[model samples]
Target: MDVADGVLVAGYRIVRRLGSGGMGTVYLAQHPRLPRWDALKVLDDRHDSDSEFHARFLREAELAARLQHPNLVAVHDRGEDHGRLWIAMQYIDGGDLAGLIRRGPQVLTVERAVRILGDAAAGLDEIHRAGLLHRDVKPANILLTTDADGSDRVLVTDFGVAHPIEDGVKQSGGVATTLAYAAPEQFGDGPVDHRADVYALGCTLYQMLTGSVPFPRTGAGSVMYAHLHEPPPRPSAANPQVPKDFDAVIATAMAKNPADRFASCGALAAAARAALTPTPRRRATRLSVAALVIILVAAAALVGVLSRTTPSQARPVRTPVSGSVDGSQWGAFAYIAQAFPDLLPGFPYGSGYEELSGCLPQDTKYNNVPLDTSLPIGTLFCLGNRDPVIDLEIVCNADRTPIQPGVALADFPEGDEAWSRPSGSGHLFWGHTTFTDTGSDLDGHTTGVLEIFFDRADRNFCRIQVVGTPTTGADLRAAWWPGAPL
Candidate 1:
């Protein structure tokens, strides 16, 4: 019902209308007992006779009220007044994301898009954790507010289309999804879960980055048909300024097969954050002799200590090789340190390496770290070694394989197996292993030997590969200790 201003609905005094949609009308209302104002949502009076619509309205209130997360809108109370059901929620002064995108340059920056959608992803994860699915997740449904620090805090609002676990994706009627953001499975009768939300979030991220949906609305059923039969257009194609790494993130998130998508909303957000993170690059500068001497002395001392200690009882390195372990070029290191701090042990960042290159697809032609993983098979960070036969390369796995601690080196790369060991926290793995590539992009079936170490915690997939000179597993372990220089 269109209640006039100054009217009371369930003890909340209606001040003015905020907005209205297919679900109901939202009003800015002042609470009777509290001094704060609340957004009062009144269910449509026309649906009072329909039990299904009424139940859906109450379900939204109940589901949202139980979810208590900063990323989600808070539900205060719900009741029926004047034969109309009403739910009171926190009132946000800022407008929705849709309005922001439309008013601005029609798109948001990578940082802002990630920030807004990352928070929204957390809210979606919370909803999934509550055994509920927000079937309708669009930019218009996301409300953005400013925090005390003047930072944007986005909250996922409008749970009117939330589906409970009991529904099992079969809503009796046809797909109840927005055509632009709906997952392919939503079109046909299949089981919908948290992945459906992931698909929609991916679409939302695509819009935020490219200022347009994956598929344009060409006709009545063309967009829906494209979502079912076609692949999503790359965000970079629409906006050249969009980072290349985002292409893979969006592709995986919008994968037609739910099995191919990330396991959860949190995983998708983590991937997006990681994609936006910069990788290490080589700088045009000379290394200091004093720093080099210090690193060499530390490495020598570490080797001597390892000679005495047993493999199982090896000690953790206490001192950093240098103060500049986390350098300006070490962007991936910074990214990992931000999320998983213990994974990176302040290894001298800018001191050792002369040239850093990623193992790209065939004939990619690169002199520096690639901006995206479009053709990345792995990363190779080369150090300036005097002996041509000896290659010291840092292998960062871009294959996205999930390698865990205690796994043998033979299991990961093909070659002669030597030895492998895990760090104290089981987040990093260092192994001196040999592998033979048969017609591969990197080595081309040639038998090669290398000492490899990778971060097994997050999806950074960073690995340190030392080719030539096959040393004992224990020696490699001690030589490449966490805080020691490479």
Candidate 2:
């Protein structure tokens, strides 16, 4: 089999070729046991004839597999089959830096470009720490993937074939068509080092910023001469929006002399980050030393007293969940409607709604209760609607667990924040916690959380959450609740 579609190599089922490079042809393959996919790099059989290269490939494959870093593409498994060397790596769905750059400035903003570079730098530094040099560092070698949580993760690829630091070799001597990213020493007699990769990274950043390579020379002789002699081009000159500091950064990274270049790829990336960051302005006003000392001393005294306390009553464990939860019954809605008819100013803005939800996903907005694992099981939702469509849901469970009073307050951190005692309630005593410190609703706006523990013998365990609009704890508690009237 040609290791084409439907062919199996070392138990990996080949799907299709992802890409090909000088090292080998890459194929998309399915793991033998897992349902997930892997990018399998199979070296050409022609190179397998060289015994020395074969030994090196296996040794380095093992080394690459040993590396475990979030920013580096993980090498999962490697083996030889039918006189071919193959290595399986993590498949990144987000495509390569070259492809992202091809999309131009509309997609690759300066902040995004710097962030991606920082991730690549971290991975590159890790490889260097492992005594390896990624000689061919370019946009094509950088891979991108997004996590399930909607965060972008950039991983470095092709480290399996990277040269060990001991292999001090002259890389780009005479003339080459692909010397666009080659360092100066590559075309000279001096031994090439990690600085070569730094130079290439600088070149990559240049292309990412300007939408074109630093030197677009076509002729082999011209390219060689440019790499050996020409000074690094300024990205700001091409794209005025690029910070001027980046020009100095590129110059240092692509410095003609190896010693003149940055000590490490991380340093270059850090410089780039600094270039992007605006200098912080010094605060003119200063707090008096005596006033600051008094505040600290008072806080220390309060912390000592509060630290000695505990919650009078231990809260009940969460309710057990079964199948999908029923939302049709206006569980908490009926109570809120009677208690505070004005809370949900009906139809004009947001739909009047409520849900008796089981353990909903943490991301769900309709279920406003802050679902801490330690809390009671039942959930009651109340929709007191507002603008850009904001809704409030208060989930309450009927759990009557008795405990002693005067146990002491559980926590008292610095600030005016304190758990106020629920006394003299008319209908429902409101307790509030804001989601600004917690997390946003599904719609990504800050949400506020509330848990109302009714002081009655039954002691209904209630949690209310405001979703959609950014809200303050003090403001929400004072205004949003439906207190006594019902």
Candidate 3:
């Protein structure tokens, strides 16, 4: 088909062919009015008269459109242009994960693998939450994009083969799914649900981390048999740097029985996050410092050993400032503020106080304090006592060493230095909240903290930061307490 022969559909001008697959051919298109671009998938005319295929296609489109998540590609509009069925979706500039792996180095860092799979899990969770299963989840269906801020983001696409949970009818012969990533249930009459997606995600993650499929077989039936009976080897066996916990997570996700796997995609994502945590000792060191500092300060005040200082004695905390000050309320405001322009639009801006104005209560007593009391660990805040402002930083520490403070705010810039010196707007009264390690050897603890800041009389921000620790949840709970007096 010639690219220029078709009329513009839904105001998107088709530029050129992107790629063709079993479902349809995708075209590169641009919105006539908006600056955004899109990929338009047009089903071939051969299927137009087939009612069953059309119904299935429409159902898939409806299901995909209902899902709105960061890791899922969004469908913008669907219609017929010149008697051809077409769907417009957000255009991702980057290539598929499979292509990236096939080219050059093929191996991925443990952090990169976990992060990508975690994002895909989140997307799958959203899909399952909507009562749909991505029957065809594979590396080729997962797209990778680097935001303007340089953070890697994963987008799960091509849900044309996805099955709706409520629909009892089985899809008849025609298009075949990728065997490499297909779960065993997909090969037979076993019950399929969110667990199938989990299994496929496990296979995808395995391939991504090790640069090879879990079961490499020349025949589709052989691969399916392996998925049905064999337990995949640990990724750490291939790459020593991969954590043992990750191996357990993958094994669990790829369990032969659906009941043996995580209950949902969200659970799998949470497990992946837990497995991705670095050695416990380092995490503990990050958490310990924050906990110890808070405890010591509290203890000193409780005992007669340290006198409580009046507001006059408090000093104005100085630190660099920029972007929206309201970010402080969420614990990683500074990072989000600096990262917004590159990550997303519509960032609030003004004096730090002005940016935070809407989030603050009218009552002066709680003016600068975060509205949310029970925040995720590692949130930073700005405290002022009607006089000089104090930079209140909370961070995770293990073995007494502070992990850099600030939460990983969505749509925020990603980099170690970005957390330290965020771009744009400047004032300095900085404080970082950190977690600490509690083990005898600092190797077992995980540190996580939130950061918030009050600078001069204007700019202030809050943020949450976390570092993994080897310590248990009980110890973390015991050590976690805001330093403010009750």
Candidate models: Cα lDDT each: 0.63, 0.59, 0.55
Worst ten in a row by lDDT for model 2 = 317-326
Candidate 2 structure quality by residue, lDDT tens digits, 1-486: 135689998889999766554366678899999999999888756566788667766775777876789998888889987778888888887778765664445467888899888889899888888877777677777888788887678888875447777878654424221356788777766677777878888888887776566775323345557788888889988666688889999999989988999999899999999889856332213657687778779989988876675232232211111211122222333332223232321211111222111212222243444433323444334322121113444444424243222211112111122233343231222222333333323232333333333334433333344432224333344333423111
Task: Give the winner by TM-score.
Answer: 1
User: What is the lDDT, from 0 to 100, of the residue 12 in candidate 2?
Assistant: 90
lDDT of 3 by residue, 1-486 (tens): 334525586677888666543366678898878898889888756577898677767776788999999999999888877767778888999877765443312234567777778788888888988988887787778889898898788999988778878764243442246656667666665466778888888877776665566775423345667888988769777544566787888898899888898887668778877888746564457567789778768877776633455332363212222222233423433333333322111112111220111112112232244333432322222221110111122322112232323433312222232212422322111222233342222232233322233221222332222221212222221222111111
Candidate 1: 10-residue stretch with minimal lDDT: 354-363
Q: Candidate 1: lDDT of 286?
A: 53
**Residue 457, model 1, lDDT:** 49
lDDT of 1 by residue, 93-181 (tens): 99787645432222356788888878999999999999999988877789998899988989999888888877786645555666668
For model 3 the local lDDT of residue 240 reads 49
The best-first sequence of candidates by TM-score reads: 1, 2, 3
- Please give the distance, in angstroms, between residue 384's alpha carbon in candidate 2 and its true position after superposition: 61
Q: Of the candidates shown, which would achieve the greatest lDDT relative to the real structure?
A: 1
As a TM-score, model 2 comes out at 0.55
